[model samples]
Target: MTRLGNARLVLDNEIRPGGVVFAGGLIGDIGEIGPGGDGLDLEGDYLIPGIIDLHTDNLERQTQPRANARWPSRSALVAHDAQCIAAGITTVFDALCLGDIGFGKARNQTFEDAVIDIAALRRQGALRAEHFLHLRCELPAEEMPEMLARAIEDTHVRLVSLMDHTPGLSGQYGDLVRYREMRRAEGLAPAEVETVIAELQGNHHAFHAANRALVIAAARARFIPLASHDDATETEIARNAAEGIGITEFPVSLQAARAARARGMRSIAGAPNLVRGGSHSGNVAVIDLVRENLLDALASDYVPGAMLEAAFIAAAEGAIALPAAIGLITSGPAAIAGLADRGRIAPGLRADLVQVRLHEGLPVVRAVWRGGVRVG
Candidate 1:
């Protein structure tokens, strides 16, 4: 048995000083520190459940670090996995976009390559962190239906999120002027940017509702979990609930998040938003959602490390207790994803754990273990 003691244990819903015993990749026992054990001592550092990220686009960023640069797909996959492990995420849902909205052709390539690369790496026992797919479906894209059809059958896909990035509708376009400026900064000529924006808006008007229904139907047929992205109003929340979407990935306003909570759907806030203190596009702040008790979980979104950091940050800000803060990234996400075997320090659960130390009021990951074996 592998035993760890003398540490602050972050349990499912509480934090205390304790230890745990493990064997055969399962938590065998959890309680006060034993007087004698063969395993290593934790030395009073904070030991929390390994983070489970339900949605993250860090892999896409790794695959295409910049506008004009692209790394080898397989190399990017390995780097992405390593980064996840180092961030103390034992289970990761790599959120890859399935539909292109004219931003970059490379995104489609990255999606295809990521699916193949992840499967190959997992089959070869080359991945340190558990990898799963979160399909991000862009409802306005004409090719979205075909793209979803092509990848929905993949065994690794466990979650699908409906996204509408139509300018003046959702996501980065919540602020049209800012969105236009972003496109121009991407090196697109002013006229070209306006033309593309017009085309996107037209596509949204013509296809969003139909494509959203199709994607929802596809997810329902497969029994895959469904998430609604960047919901901005109570109407969107009500519509999503009526359509049986169980998770709200990023509600953009307090009213939307409250509506989701009232509908019994989980509200996921981005960890990066909490870490940065506000939304990049001037939407509702995550701290505000926490204050209102509207946020149910926190996703890494784009930064894997943000999961761990945000938990500590939220706790330090006194918005919630540390254990409750940890739940936003750990038990909260795992439960949202329907993962029952991991995400907490409990007997008979998967032995996925992280050792963290606070330095100057910031949590720093010191080590990680998945399945009772150190991997980072």
Candidate 2:
């Protein structure tokens, strides 16, 4: 048994200064004003639930830094897992792009294979953090259905999202010049860029229908959570909800977010957007979503540390209460991912917790525990 005392415990809906006890990998007890026991004292620091990250592309970045710059799957998985633990994330859904857009390094079969191999390694006890899969389906890719079938059948996929990046369709890549610049930075030749764009335009309609059906079928068959990425319009949000997608990730406008809420679907925004004060892609501001109470959760899309920081920012900015802000990283995400056993500091719940201290008005993680064991 282990006891953590002298901490501000962020409990279900309130913050109480108390001590928490853990045994058998679950929270044993929590009470106010407890004396010293045979465990460590946190010295009045903040004890928050371990972060549950639902969407992150960091693994894909680790797998391929640039075009043709591939790293070994084992090394990348180990390094990614370590980073996640150090960032205070006890649970992570590694988002892998499943498509063959033929424009960047992430469009290759090796990306899919790496996901399978990493899941296998994690099952063999070679990973530091609890890992799951979130497959991103690009609608214009011809090979999307096959990849979705393989991922769903593998049983490691817990979430799947429909992402359409066709230049004019979703407005996500509306700036064609910017898109070309990004492609050029990846060393794509002019001819290759033109060819890929032409192919995407030519197959837009057929690919959209096929990918949408595949996503819905796979999610229904496997009972996996389905999400829509970068929803830009009210119609798009309605269409996705009608197709049984229960989560809206990074809606481009407040109208779309409100539409999602009306459909009883959660609206998720990237934590980095809140930390940076706006979206890097020029989408809707996350703070607006918070103020409107339309946001259900915050995802650490690219930067893992942004999750905790955003929560603190929301509290400090008066956008939400401390407990509500913390939930965006903890219970909110865990519930969205269907992880009911974690994200709360209560008896019988998994002892995934983080000891943090506020430094210059920002949350600084001092340590992390996963399943009653110190991992970072």
Candidate 3:
């Protein structure tokens, strides 16, 4: 058994000074500091549940660190897993893109290789965090349907998000001119940006409905949780709800988030949004969602460490209590991802925990343990 004392335990609904005891990879007890325990003293740090990140594209960033450079798939997978573990993420859904709209052909290559790499690492017992797949399907891509068919059967695919990145249609790039500018800033010539935009619009017009149907059918058949990415309106939320999508990722406006909540769908805001104090894309600020009680959870999105920083930021803002704020990265996400074994400091639960030290309003992970064993 392992006992950890002298820490503030962040529970599901409250935070209290206590300790945790675990054995056989499960929590054995949790309460006040008990007598005669063979464990380490945490020295009054904060003990929170190990973070569960539902959607992170950090792996993609690691794989393609530069515009024209690609890292080896297995090496990138290891790097990604290590970064997640160091960030106190015990459970991570490596969000991989399944389709491309005439750009970033390398994303398709990384997608194909990541599945094999993750499977091999798992079989070899080389992974630190428990990794799962979150397939981000591009609804307007011609190959999306076929690509998804190849991965939906994989055991690691726990979450599937329907992503439509077609400019001026839906999602982050709702304004065509803004999308064009963004592309141009990425070094695409003005003509190329306009051409790419037109091509994407054409793809959306030709393939969006059929691809969305295929994705929905596959997700429903497997009973995996479905998420709608970048929902921008009440009508979009209603359509997703009618299609049985229970989560709305990064809704672009307060109305859409509120509508999602009204429909019993959880609204996920990017952790970076909270850390940066606003959305980079000029979308709805997460603090506004927090104030309105429209936010259910916070996803890392593209940065693993942003999850921890955002949780502390939310608490510091007084928008929510410390425990509830922490929940945005812990139990809230675990529940959303259908993981019931961890995410709380309670007996009989999986002992996935992290020790955090607060320094000048910033929270830093000091140590981490997964299933009663120290992993970081």
Candidate 4:
């Protein structure tokens, strides 16, 4: 048994200064402690639930820092897991892109292989943080259906997102000229870039229709949650809802976010958007979504530390109470991923907790516990 005391515990909808006890990987008790027990005092810092990261591409970036520069899968997974734990992320869904857009660093079968390798490592208990797969499927990819089918076969595949980044279709890849420049920077020949663009344009509609069917079918078959990424229009939200996607990730506009909420779907905005005060891609600001009561959760799209930082930012901005802000990184994401346990400071919940110390108005992780054991 482990007892953590002298901290403000962020529980459901409130923050209470109390001690939390854990035994056998579950929260045993939570209340005031008056000595006479083995306890580790946190000296009145904040003790919040271990962060749950729903969307992170850090693993993919670690695996392939540069184009064609592939690192060993096990090494990359270990490094990514360590970084997540150190950043207070107890649960992480590694976002792996599945697409044949003929652009970007990860645009081939190598990505699929990397996902498989990560799953294998997780099954072997080689990963420090609890890892799951978040397959980012490009709807315009011709082979996405087959890839989705294969990925769903893995029990670790917890979430799937349908993405459509075709130029002129979704504003996600906003400017085609910028896309062309990026491709050129990646060393794509002019002829090859034109051919790929033509191919993407030619098959955009058909691939979108086919991939949507595959995503819906896979979600049902695997009982995995489905999300629509970069929704820019109300029609897109309606279409996603019709296909049974209950999560809208990073809607490009307020209208799309409102439509998502109307359809009973959770609207997830990137934590980076909150920290940076705006979207890097010039999309909808997460603070605006929070103000409008349209935001349901915050995802660490690429920055693991942004989860906690965004929560504090939300609290400081009066967008939500401290506990509610913390929920955006904890219970909200756990529930979205169907993780019924953990994410709360209550008995019988998994003892996934983090001790945070504030430094210059930023939350820094002092310690992390996963399942009653001190992991970091």
Name the better of 1 and 2 by TM-score: 1
lDDT of 2 by residue, 1-376 (tens): 8888889999878998988889888998988745476678888888999999999878766777665688777777788888888789999988888886655545455556666687688779887678888888888788888777677766668888888888655657766777777777877898878777777777777688867886888788889899998888899888888777899998988899999998999978899999999988778899999999998899899988899999999999999998999999999998898899999888899999999999889788998999999989
Show where candidate 2 strays beyond 4 Å. 33-35, 66-68, 105-110, 184-192
lDDT by residue (tens digit), candidate 3, 198-229:
89999999999989999999999999999999
If ranked by TM-score, best first, what sequence of candidates would result? 3, 1, 2, 4
Ranking by lDDT: 3, 1, 4, 2
Clashing residue pairs in all predictions, respectively, total: 0, 0, 0, 0
lDDT of 4 by residue, 1-376 (tens): 8989888888987888888999999999999853345699888889999899999988777778776698877788788899899989999988888877656546454566766777688779887789888888888888777777677787788998988888655757756787777777778898887887778887786778877787778788878999999999899899888878899998999999999999899978899999999988778889989888898788888888899999999999998888988988899998899898978888999999999998988889999999998999
What lDDT score belongs to each candidate, Candidate 1 first?
A: 0.89, 0.84, 0.91, 0.85
Residue pairs of candidate 3 with colliding backbone atoms? none
* Model 1 weakest lDDT span, ten residues long: 34-43
- For model 2, how many clashes? 0
Please provide TM-scores, in order, for all candidate models, with all chains considered together.
0.97, 0.94, 0.98, 0.94
Q: Candidate 4, which segments miss by more than 4 Å at Cα? A: 34-37, 104-110, 177-194
Q: For model 2, what is the error of residue 219's alpha carbon versus the real structure, in angstroms, after optimal superposition?
A: 1.0
Highest TM-score model number: 3
Pitting candidate 1 against candidate 4, the one with the higher TM-score is 1
